[model samples]
Target: MAKYEALGLIETFGLVFVLEAADAMCKAADVELIGYANVASGYISVLVQGDVGACKTAVEAGVAAVKAMEGGNLYSSIVIPRPHQDLGKIIKRYSITNLVTE
Candidate 1:
């Protein structure tokens, strides 16, 4: 979404599985691991960006990776193609750059 042609997200419980999913998604497709969010309830949402097809593939790979884990409990998965430009403004408020750096 935002400036990206497509955006994929996988939100699941547990940090380990979500991280693994993110890694697998990146390796499985031509996509970028943009960022991730962790909520107080131990839910982690991993975000990836690329073309529509790539984003779909990456999201499936990510969800599958999480499903392969014994305790993985995937909550939601989404793929947004050609999201509105204004979405970037909201996403920037999250400071995804800082998340990647540290």
Candidate 2:
């Protein structure tokens, strides 16, 4: 099983806001940034992994950060506790390790 107990996602309207949200998420809890996905048309989703509680706190912080940003518009956010193992197949592609090596 993966070490992470939960998966958190924060979607925003623009790159800048998503970046800010990512920063806030990492800083607010013991979570690891799992890189981000650009969903096109200025929409982006930042992912994070950690324990259930940490993921919850991180998502909250991320949403708040985006809301506080001048031009930020949050699309949505979620914390999935104990995600299905099958979900890992898709998440691996967006892992930070891939971002660092590529």
Candidate 3:
């Protein structure tokens, strides 16, 4: 079983912002970059998994980094502590076409 107890999601617009958020999230805490979902119309979500505290820290860092960008616009940031087991099914349903890649 995965040791991760929390999941962090940082949603932002544009590939540039996504990259920035992901970089910040990874650098700020000991988390694993699971994957991302591109929700369409340039909206992307960067997902990370780790301990609750680490996820919180990473999300905060990711949000701060996005806000620091000149034209950065952070749509939302979420921390799901002890996400449901079925969450994986929902995530997997997101089309691969919607996977964010730059």
Candidate 4:
């Protein structure tokens, strides 16, 4: 399966509330959430990994779903990162592991 990396910017209703919803949406999409960073203003940046088609579809679906919610706003950009290299290495490096399981 081909791997894809995506960067999503979510403008949430509220930090905590929307973050919870984002988490749920990511889980439902089967996205391998690599890492996230809170921007200076009020944007949450996310990095995720998945199959090319699945990731694109999921990202669009997730954004639409969020927009449908009572108070949610989100946008995303899918990036290949490099000319001919996959972003798997970066994804793996930033992936959150379950310490107990590890």
lDDT of 3 by residue, 13-52 (tens): 9999999999999999999888788889999998888999
| Model 3, CA-based lDDT | 0.88
lDDT against the true structure, each candidate: 0.84, 0.91, 0.88, 0.51
RMSD (CA, angstroms), candidate 2 = 1.3
Model 3 Cα displacement at 8 (Å)?
0.2
Worst 10 residues of 2 by lDDT: 93-102
- Candidate 1 lDDT tens digits, 1-102: 445798888998888988888898999899988788886589888888889999999999888988988887999999999878887665555446866664
Each candidate structure's TM-score, on Cα atoms with residue i matched to residue i, is 0.88, 0.93, 0.87, 0.56
Model 2 backbone overlap count: 0
- Model 1 spans with C-alpha error above 4 angstroms: 1-3, 100-102
Q: For residue 80, what is the lDDT in candidate 3?
A: 96
The collision pairs in model 2 are none
Ranked by lDDT from best down, the candidates are 2, 3, 1, 4
Which candidate do you rate higher for TM-score, 2 or 4?
2
User: lDDT tens string, model 2, 1-102?
Assistant: 288899999999988899899999999999988888888898999999999999999999999999988877999999999999999888888877887853
Sliding window of 10 residues with minimal summed lDDT for model 3: 91-100
Which ranking of candidates, highest TM-score first? 2, 1, 3, 4
The clash tally of candidate 4 reads: 0
